[model samples]
Target: MGNLYLARHCKTAWNLEHRIQGRTDIPLCEIGIEEAKMNVGFLEALKISKIYSSPLTRGRQTATIYATALEVPYETRDGLLEMDMGEWEGKTALELSALKPSLYLQWIEDPRNVPLVPGSKEDVFTAQRRILSTILAIYKENDEEKNVLVIIHKYICSLLRCALQGLELNHFKKEIIETTLPQNLSIVSSQVIEKCLSNC
Candidate 1:
């Protein structure tokens, strides 16, 4: 029964431009590095036993900062990777709306039902199952850890949050996406994981 500290990676240049960064290997911007440093104190107080991160540069960079500050070991996992956005990788929301209004509107109305992009390998439901399984595996493996930090991308974090709260995938855009901002942490308790699994 451990606490999972789920955090989104700090901002990248693409984040400022409001570009979709799904599966893109963008490094952290200067401000993103500083933001990670600033948030160290809060995370340090959690006494994190270990840190897990997405393999993406941004996620790894943020986890490295916290791991160094907290003096904890850290590792990366592929399951924590951002959803593959395919053709939408570098486009901004406005551009997507302009270029593919129907696709964009379909996503906005029902994210779970639509393909992330034309060539993407995983849908929202697939991503959700991957993240949840990864998290449950981590929890089971590190039973002794009082607090474990998991740094991942914004969309991945939102998906995990939505699942942990026992909400359906359709609730992701309306309930979780906007609120799951970068550098923000969401606490997931053992009981919450149990509840999530039971619901599944």
Candidate 2:
């Protein structure tokens, strides 16, 4: 079993604009670069052994800073990819509400039960399954004492945290807001995740 430190990629230009960047390959803005650098201090004492990230540019960029600084092996994992928001990918909340108020409200109230788009849109449960499997597989590959760093997006991070805490996917909204707030980094032991999965 390994310990994992999960981080959401830092801010982007779209993030600054309050946009939904799901599955869009936007790079980190200048503020995002600085934000990731700031996290370096927080990670200085963690002694992370390996780094994994979403294949997206923002996640890759943020992970690169830490991987280079700590001299750890870094790789991109497809399972870490952000949710595919479909038609809503580049739209802001305000825009989405204006376009489809009822749908937007439904999403805000219960994202796990609502579909953002008609077809081919990624839902919370699907993404959670992918991310949970990825983390579990990674956990099985490492020793109990190893510390693994994984970076992805805010929504995925929230779902992963819910799983680690043995919470249902529906509880994701009740959990702390990881995207717009601090404490975007979460640490969970591999054993806890395994137990959570076994009980399920």
Among residues 3 or more apart in sequence or in different chains, the pairs in candidate 1 whose N, CA or C atoms overlap within 3 Å are none
TM-score of 2: 0.86
Span of ten consecutive residues with least summed lDDT in model 1: 176-185
lDDT for position 129 in model 1: 74
Winning model by lDDT: 1
Per-residue alpha-carbon lDDT of model 1 for 60-83, expressed as tens digits? 999898889889899999999998
Which ranges of candidate 1 are over 4 A from the true structure? 177-200
For all predicted structures, in order, the TM-scores are 0.87, 0.86
What are the clashing pairs of model 2?
A: 1-144
Error of 2 at 175 (Å): 2.8
Measured with C-alpha atoms, the lDDT of residue 114 in candidate 1 is: 78
RMSD to the true structure for each prediction, in A, is 2.8, 2.8
Candidate 2, residues 17-128: lDDT per residue as tens digits?
9888888899999999998888888877877888888899998999898888888889999999987777777889788778644575566556755744444466667777
